[model samples]
Target chain A: MSTSRERVLARVRAALTDVPADEPVVRPVERPYADSHGMGAALEVLEDRLRDYKALVRRVPADRLAEEVAAALERRGASTVAVPDGIDADWFSRTEAVRRPDSRDRPLELRELDSVDGVVTACAVAIAETGTIVLDGGPDQGRRAITLVPDYHLCVVRADQVVDGVPQGVRRLDPARPLTWISGPSATSDIELNRVEGVHGPRTLEVLLVE
Target chain B: MSATFLGIPPFPEAARAAVNDSRLRHNLRKATHTIRDKRGAVVTELEDDWERLRSEGAAIKSHTLRHLDHYLEQLEASVERAGGHVHWAADAEEANEIVTRLVRATGETDVVKVKSMATQEIELNNALAEAGITAYETDLAELIVQLGDDLPSHILVPAIHLGRAQIRETFLAQMAEWGVPAPEGLTDDPRALAEAARVHLRERFLRTRTAISGANFAVADSGTLVVLESEGNGRMCLTLPETLISVVGIEKIVPTWADLEVFLQTLPRSSTGERMNPYTSTWTGVTPGDGPQEFHLVLLDNGRTDVLADTVGRQALRCIRCSACLNTCPVYERTGGHAYGSVYPGPIGAILTPQLRGMSSEVDEALPYASSLCGACYEVCPVAIDIPEVLVHLREEVAAGSGHLGEKAVMKGAEAVLGSSHALEAAQRAAGAARNLVPRHLPGMAGAWTDTRDLPDVPAESFRQWWNKHEKGQS
Candidate 1:
């Protein structure tokens, strides 16, 4: 029997017989769009966009990062926080919550992730124009479920990691790894096209922007 | 729970009923207008580059479609290399069978689903149910539609036709039957509703071992499938499941990874009118310890080749399903999605459904005429699909096909009369002389056209006669 793959490809080839034999398979596409908006205040812009999505954003200096994270988690009353593999231990040193570290060898169970009060992780890249933070399952970010299953997400973004636009953000990432690009907490406009936040994903997205 | 678009009335009949519906009209108007304004505001923010980005998006899709076979092979090879199995499905049945078998192979009867147009188009959920395998729709809108036993009206918001009150009622009435019961005091507040859905679906996401999804864009170079969504259900389904199956339309391919820059920038703005939707998940294949352990990609053709066959019609394949066209369409805003009677509705549906399904059915034939050809859809389309051009092209195809014998005969006679000056003048004179004898309504099937419209009164004399008299000074 002929494989469906062969049959589908055959149909496709048969359908496109009009193309010239010499036509290049890949042609240069014109991109007149700018690579970057060149908004020099990418951090401020990122903050504004993040706040616009109702995500709580706080900027702190490098030395105050751990203190701010601890305060934010305390404010949220998060008693149990899931920490990814490579997240700095110092960042949670001042926190009162018990740390549950997730690693490849000893990953947290789905129930444990669900039961955790919050999750803390680092991002791969942040897009200023869209206010999106991308996680590529890096050691610091751990598995995608760590930030997802939990109701609260405390993502740390560095000032240096922010890109001015989506194009710049896309160019900086590797597609081979699984990536979760989150702009805000999960939202929906399904009911009468009204924007409603905090659905399925974490309800609270608190970003600690370390300069 | 088995709601389908099958056996729906044709566009004219369906649209007439829809237009008369006051509540549906109010909901559609409010929703479409809100999104339209939001889209305008966000799109204007990129005023300097929006058009260029849209053109670039169109060019990239065109380039990919022209060499689709090459890219499909590349995508398949890349996916396999990334430890994901690739299955080719010629049509809906093949795709559904493959998904069902894959689920059964895992000995799992239940699978969580991200909102996917491809799966909806193939009715995968229905197929799974037939095999005694239940598929849970995890998207809030999809969940509402599934629980309410309703067909999806809009592409982005499947239950766009239903208001918040209706949703709360649905949850209160049906949530328990599905899984978790809705809270007793659940109000119609959008936040409370969203919270209810989150709480209800959380258990399923954590428990369901298998998931099915669809891709917004499939990067051929990297074998990456990207799904941009506002809610996190997509992330849960893509991440938590042990075995992931994505049934993707073949046309969802982008030639390169860098090409995502064009679509990612345009899609969110064009879709939910956000700078970026809340969540976008991208996965190439199975990651060892991070996401799904096993991944299967089913490439679906299902009339896409037929769509590709027509050079003019092939542009419909460029659609990203952003649905900006639907929100901006005047005809769509009034009649809403159900009138088009396809999973895809609005201007895209008018051209797309007919091409995908062929113009054999009354619904398909009427779809090409569903538009006023106002060009609003083309203006807002992120990929720049010239919807009006396709509508006219499809109209011509539908007209040339079988049926409409009476209309065809009338057109043929009128063609001869209008083709010659002598015949036209004589016919005009005859019409003028017999003006009083002409009935207001035509006989038989021809009356259908004049039923809701008035026939133009015959002029006392044709324009040609007046022109001749003035030129000859014989007025």
Candidate 2:
């Protein structure tokens, strides 16, 4: 029998026989939409959008990020935090939580990460309009597992990384890297279509925005 | 019994039972209205460019479908180059066989699954069960369907037909048989129900060696596959599994990365009424020591090429499976989803099922007439599917079928009578003379129409006669 690949392609050709073979493949479509919808300052919009989703949002001066991070973790009463390497070590100096740094050669097991109280990581880019933060497994972000398995997530986003909309965020992202876009703590609408926060991933998401 | 049934009766017959089921009617009404209201509120907040985004989405899809052969080949080559293996399956059977074989080769008996419509279209879970591999559905809604032994009713929330009380009962009664039992004293609260699911699926995610999923979008320029979900269960399945397999339909492809701007803005709001979902994951291929080590992509056709053949019907391929049309459809709201007898239910199904599966089944033939043609679906469709146009087209096809001979003859007679003045005049005179004798319920073929609707009383006088008798009217 002919391979499924050959058969499927033949069917596709038969299906689109009317679409001229010589016809141009890339028909220019008009994306007349603005690059981003700017309501106000990106930082202000980001904080408002994040708060709307019930996520804890805090903005602090760049120099005071370490103090803010320590305060947030203390507020959550997290005793242990899974931190990625290359994250500024000074950020966790004030917090008494056992800082377990993720290792590249010996990655933390999912169960071990699950036992930790929370995770602290840096973001790749943040979209202010949608209140989304993208993680591309950059040095400070670590692998997808460390952030996912923990019950709480404390992601630090710099003011320079924030954009106004999804289009701008996409332009800045490298598609080759695995990307995770998060808008809020994990939520589900499956039960009678009720939107309830806290289903699977980290239930509490605290964002420490540094100007 | 699971809404998970197959080869059922025609839609009208099936709908008769659902229309009378007060509980289902109540459940569907509550769920659909909630989503509809939420969707309306968020969409109204858009910055005057929602229409532009919709048009951009439609144009991008149109361009890709027209040149699908080229884009699909590019996708396959790119995926292979990115350290992922790709397989093409011409139909559901071939796709199921390939997936089952892949599982068999892994030497594993159990696998974790993310909520995937493509796999549901092929009934992958059932296929895997027959092959002696138990696939655990990790999504909260899917877990409800699996435990309740029900078919998915809605695309976004598969168990939308079951209320909270019923969900509590399902968890209490069925959790132990599957795995970890729900905590005792569980109530109908949504938060408690979600918590139980999280704990129940956590163990499976940790232990399962294989994961299966479907992609919401596949970018052709790169080999990336994107899955959007609210709960973290998808994150667990995508991240923790040692090997990952994704089955995606051909129509899910986009030509480039930039096109995501259109869908990303529209899908989350249209689906769950959120500015953005909680978790959206995009992966190009297998990365060294990250996520899944072995990645496989199954490109499924399964009658999509057939649907794409009809120039008029192929527009159904543009569906992003947001379920916005289902939530807004009046017909869908009343009958719920089970009446449609397909995984894809409601307005999208009315056009898509008949094209994908053909008019051979009575259910497929009846689906074309399931709507009131209110045009609500067209208004809400993000990709601009002209639903009424496709419904009328499908109606023409159904009307031309063998079963409709009697109705066809009656329509032809009515047309001939209306065409000539003499035939019309005579018929009107005869009807006027016997107006009192007309039955409220007609017999035989006409009974199908009169059974649910009262036949109109024959008028006492024809319009032409009234016009001819009025002198100058103004006088």
Best by TM-score: 2
lDDT of 1 at B438: 82
Candidate 1, superposed: residue stretches over 4 Å from native: B406-475
Q: How does model 2 fare in lDDT?
A: 0.89
DockQ of each: 0.80, 0.77
- Classified by CAPRI criteria, candidate 2 counts as medium
Residues B1-475, candidate 2: write the lDDT tens digits: 1235476766766776777789999999999999999888777777578888888888899889888889999999889889999999999999999899998988999999999999999988888998999999989999999998878889999999999999999999999999999999998899999999988988888899999999999999899999999998898889888889999999999999889998999999898888899899999988787799899999999999998988999899999999999999998998888889988999999999889887768788888888889999999998999988999999998887765565777788779999999999998989888999988777776554454345788888878777877856847
Highest lDDT: give the candidate number.
1
Kindly report which residue stretches of model 2 are placed more than 4 angstroms away from their true locations once superposed.
B1-3, B409-443, B450-475
Pick out the ten consecutive residues of candidate 2 chain B with the lowest summed lDDT: B445-454
Model 1, docking class? medium
Local lDDT at A56 for model 1: 98
